[model samples]
Target: MDDPMQTVYVWLDDEGHRTVLLFALAAALGLASVIYFVLTGEGSPTRLQLVLILAAGAVLFYVSLRSTAF
Candidate 1:
């Protein structure tokens, strides 16, 4: 029998795990960015930027969902 670990690439997550990770990571990053902006007095992301971020998150989510499940 083949080594299952050898065949594995995605670190053993369920089908929807990637979607969860993508959204979660994006949310974490977005929150961090917001906090950083507030602390550093930097420009915050615009509404359009948030929309694009959500779009990117959705694309990542769907792509992750459609990918192989370990």
Candidate 2:
């Protein structure tokens, strides 16, 4: 059995590299979206656009959780 009180660090070790990459990809996508919207003068992002951004974030979150899971 594992030590119940031992803290699991998610973003502070070798496994964190994958999580960092996922977060980087999400950030890049978000930045590109903002740039495109600003240059095109789109008053608001469409539903699909928002969904895509959220999807990227969700994927990152999922990966982080999976990595930390025992």
**lDDT per model vs. reference:** 0.63, 0.71
Write candidate 2's Cα lDDT for 1-67 as tens digits. 6654443443345566766777888887777767767787778887756876887778777776787
Per-residue alpha-carbon lDDT of candidate 1 for residues 13-64, written as tens digits (9 for 90 to 100) = 6546656766677776566656655676646666645665676677667766
Q: Judged by lDDT against the true structure, how good is candidate 2?
A: 0.71
| CA RMSD, predictions in order | 6.3, 10.1
Q: Ten consecutive residues with minimal summed lDDT in candidate 2? A: 4-13
With candidate 2 superimposed using the best TM-score fit, by how many Å does residue 59's alpha carbon deviate from the native? 2.1
Task: Tell me the deviation in Å of residue 10 in model 1.
Answer: 7.3
Give the lowest summed-lDDT range of ten residues in model 1.
6-15
Over 4 Å off, model 1: 1-12, 42-70
